[model samples]
Target chain A: MSPVLEVRGLTAGYGSLTVLRDVGLTVGEGEIVVVLGANGAGKTTTLRALSGLIPAQGSVVLSGTELLGRKADARARLGLGHAPEGRGTFTDLTVDENLRMGGLRLPRNELPAALDQAYGLFPQLTPLRDRAAGRLSGGEQQMLTVARALMARPRLLLLDEPSMGLAPQITANLFAELRRVNAESGTAMLLVEQNAAAALTIAHHGHVLESGHIVLSGTGSQLAGNPSVRRAYLGV
Target chain B: MALFLQRLIDGIGNGMLYGAVALALVLIYRATGMVNFAQGEMAMFCTFITWKLADHEFGLGLPIVAGIAGGVIFGFLFGAALERVVIRPFESADHLRQMIVTLGLFLAINALAAWIFTADTQRLASPFPSGALRLGGVSVSYHQLGVIAVLLVMALALRELFGRTRLGLAIRGASMNPESSRLLGVDVSRMLMIGWGLSAAIGALAGALVAPAVFVSPGMMQTLLLYGFAAAVLGGFDSAPGALVGGVMVGVVQAMVSGYVPAVGTQLQLATAFALILMVLLVRPQGLFGRVSVERV
Candidate 1:
């Protein structure tokens, strides 16, 4: 089957400072692809480029449509949902309102169902619905941010560092929830993370991005067992 | 006691006018994160527009209500267009430069109004009935009551807009974080324009309402602007509801100080507003109803 996402020769950078050079990758239908990288491996830049948050030179095909030259919002309408790093929650807004904002581009009729799905997925959020998002704990905020991205009902979800600053237990729960989401909803995910062992357990395919280049690629178990990956990322 | 009540009502009546201008400030501040220094002048311009439209020969000669409606619609379009044309270009610039641009706008708009309407003050007919409601020998004009009623209604309408509507969510979302809002498929620029447009419409209404009392002219809003700024600062520059409370407080304090405080005297009435503003800033800094912004890791 054709991949849900396809990037060819992706090159992105800030002004006068190139970070990602000629990177390429893909995520097939309903698959979880983890892009493992260190602190400055251009992992975040890759997601930003694909989501059209920053200017980049590449051919980004979502499903079948060419995604280049489109604005970030337009790309979102075309079924790309991004839950950015550091829990990109609207702190001032209530949890319910944050979810509403997440489903902002969905058709009016689809919003209710999407909201129901989000609430059902994160039952802890149901009780805290009216509370301002800023007051929520780190785990709850992360859940809120992820749930919010899911509200878009995207064909592919781009998650940047979902485990950063999360406790080990919270990160495990988050990954488990992500696994359930992938298995049940068939939403393809391009998860960029430094948490290799946790990411590998859920990821169907894994690629190690080093200095903006894909240096390793294999099945999840293969990357997880590799000595270099185990030393560099898994820290085992 | 009757004299005090009269003074209180009189203070509230004028407070409502200040509140209207303060609402305009809060609206623009919420959307764009910068105060439009030209907001008062924008209102002054709209008041002139209302005056011309209500003129017997030079304009449509519509009734006062119709003229004000025309002015509001015109103001909406004018403010929205200005956001797109004049403000949007420098929106990405630093706040200081943007503020300077608005100050330039203040000067330019004042000049434009002076050139078009001349420097003469024109009397605007009040749509409210010319009468007073007498209770315990305290006479309250219908016009004063009408101003307070209109301001309350505007506040209620604004509350509904921000609380229950999808468009309101979009506006709030954009104001909070344009980057995330864009990812959610919101057109941040368009929302900002709407904010400016709505603010202008409200400012126009304020201009028409105040015009009947002070008379419309190029400089009519000069003093009113100071009061409006004081109200916004006192209420918390970012809070709509704060603007209402701040406005009434400024008005009452000014009125009472001028009336009863022998040391302050009527001549130092403006000073009273300044003093209140200073006190609030020193004590709360966030204003009465403003939430102190919390940054997260």
Candidate 2:
């Protein structure tokens, strides 16, 4: 499969402190690539840097366009959907409004279809469309976040810790939905997660990030079965 | 009873003017999370622009209505330019810094208007005909009725804009969560600029509406600004509707206090208005219609 996203020599930090150094990765067309890391491992930072949420020194090419130095909104309009950490829902806005915001760049004629597609993917959100996003439960908010990201119909979706604070069963269902989205829509995804076992279950390939560096890389099963990865991440 | 009714009607007319200014304040506050100390001065400047456009002897000899329209358009461009040029640099700055910048603008814009317009109070022709309609021993002047009618229409139009339009949704989303909004392709910066522009446009209209009452001068909006701030606080800083209601309440209380209270009359009107606001705030810290924000850690 051809690469849809490519990054090389990404170095980013918060004012005076460098967190990600020489980090590099790629997502192939319709591929699910997971980056596994622990707390403070710069997993979130990497995704933010890629999405132009922060200043970074790197070469990030989405499809064929260079994304470095562009504003976050500009990058988003170029078909990069980022479901940020903590499910950055506009708490005051209704769920339907939030979905509309996600499709802000879509052609006006395509919006209804996009909304329909989003509601179909997360059927539970349909009933709560008019309710405020902050009023939704954790599982529902996560579903909304993922569903909102998909509203853009992006070529590449950057997901940060989709299982964070979610129940195991909910996480499983979410991963299953993500897998289905990948299979059906052919949208590539680059997911960062601490939940190694669950992320690996659907990821086509994976990388282990340690202190901002990619320390190991392999196919999903290869990393899942690796004794070191299992002990360190899976707590097995 | 007739006297009381007349005072109430007069109070509502003044209150609508206050509400117009307060609405402008609320718009900027919602968009940028900062209370612009310069809001009144900005309106004052736009009022001078209106005067210049309408004044036959000194400037453009356009019809008063056309001049007011020109002022509103100028206000929009001036406000948008200020946001893009002056305020955008301070977008990421802390609240204190932003407040200081607005305070500086308050002084600067006020001085700029004084220099440009010569600080002389100028007469602005009222759009309404000078007449009063009497009903049941109480009379309401056409100017008062016009102010009330115009404000109601403005408020309803604003409500429609915010409640129904895509631009309004983007602005709301941009203000509430800018970072998340950017990820949604909302162009948060542009939304913020538009917010400032819209607020200034409303302020321009407010200035034009009130110019006939207070006359056009640099210091004209000073008292109005204080009352507008009071109205915004009374209504709930986050609510557009609250600002209007708060303005009317403040106006009624001021009128009633000055008219009825023998010892403390018109001179003590501002104090009485604040006293009421303080009481209401003490009871409900969020103001009449503001939602108490609950942040999740």
Candidate 3:
């Protein structure tokens, strides 16, 4: 089977600063791939390039469909959900409205059902549905972002820093929830996490990135066991 | 006291007209996040279109109502086309540049109106009844009440449309996050066009309504635009209710202030709106309804 997403030599960045340089990675269908990196290592840039949020050079293909030059929204309509850094929820909008926006890729008739599924995935969002997204706690907002993306029924979820700044308990819960989502829906997720040990625990494949390039790639277990990976990222 | 009620009615009549214009400003701001400084000029220009259709000089043989309907249609199409051709190209540009473009439009449209209409104020007839209704000691013209009623309906319709409809959801969604909206297959550019279209159409109606009161002149709405902008800012640039309240409050206070304060003559009336805007901005930078956004670093 073809990989759900293929990134080959993808290089992109902000103006005058190249954050992602010739990065290569792939997430096979129904697999959770983790891109583990320290801060400013271009992990976020990799996702931004893949989702067409920034100018990118090189190939980013989804099931052989070229997505290198398409718009961020166009890529989204094609089932690439970007849970950007800071969760990128519409702060002024109600939780329900935020999720509905996520389902903009879905048909109007199907939106209610999809929203229901999002609420089902993250039951904490049910009560906050009528409240502004800004009112939610960070962990709640993060869950809302993930749930909102899932409303589109995206084939690949590009989640950036899902565990960032959350309490350790909340981080553990988020990882468990993400694992459940992948297992139940067979969703292909490319998670960028700072917490490498927790990330490798759930990720099927792990790629360690440094300065915009993938410095190491192997099964999660292999990277977790690698002394260098343990020292630099996992802190084992 | 009786004269006060009558003055209040007159103030409300003017306020509702200003409110419609302010609502237009709010609508465009909600969609584009930039105030259309030329909103009044655009409305006035369309009012001239109405005048051209109704005038015996360049008579299209259409009645006043038909001319108004035509003006609305033209306003919608004109706004959409202008946005597509002029504004869309500069969407990612700075706010100052955006404001300047609208200001440029203000001058262009004003000059165009002057060239066409000869800078003379023309009397336009009101479609509403001319008879006055006496409540206690105050006399209220049917036209004044008509303006208020129409303004209320337009406000309600807009509120409902933006808050309840699927298209509205998309518009709010797109305005909040254009990138994400596109991901969901919403045509953000098209929505921006629709936003401008809707705003200018309302503005046209306001122009037509107030034309009867103020006498249609090429520069008629310049003072009115100041009030509208003030109302928009005071009410929060994005809140419809804020616009309405601010418009009416400014109108009534201006009338009352000019009337009560002997030194504050009609000449000083225009300054009050600007002064109020400064106070509001200084006191609460976000305006009354604008929720201050907190950025998570």
Could you give candidate 2's per-residue lDDT for residues B1-297 as a string of tens digits?
999999999898899889899999999998888899999899989988988999998879789998899889999988998899988899989878988998999999999998988788898888889989999979998998998888888888887777777888889889888998898888888998999999999999999999999999999998998889889989999888889999998898889989999777978888976786788789987899987765344
Q: How does candidate 3 score on lDDT?
A: 0.86
- iRMSD, model 2, in Å: 1.8
List where candidate 1 sits over 4 angstroms from the true fold: A108-112
Which regions in candidate 2 have their CA more than 4 angstroms from the true location?
none
TM-score of chain B of each: 0.97, 0.97, 0.96
**RMSD of every prediction:** 1.7, 1.5, 2.3
lDDT (C-alpha, whole model) for all candidates? 0.90, 0.90, 0.86
- TM-score, first chain, each model: 0.96, 0.97, 0.96
Better of 1 and 3 by lDDT: 1
Q: After superposition, how far is residue B171 of candidate 3 from its true place, in Å?
A: 2.2
TM-score of 3: 0.93
Predictions' DockQ, in order: 0.62, 0.67, 0.44
List model 2 lDDT by residue over A1-236, tens digit each: 55899999999999999999999898999999999999999999999999988899989999989999899998998889999878599887889999988887778999999999889888889999998888888777888888888998899999999998889988998899899999999999999999999999999999999999999999999999999999999999
Ranking by DockQ: 2, 1, 3
TM-score, chain A, candidate 3 = 0.96
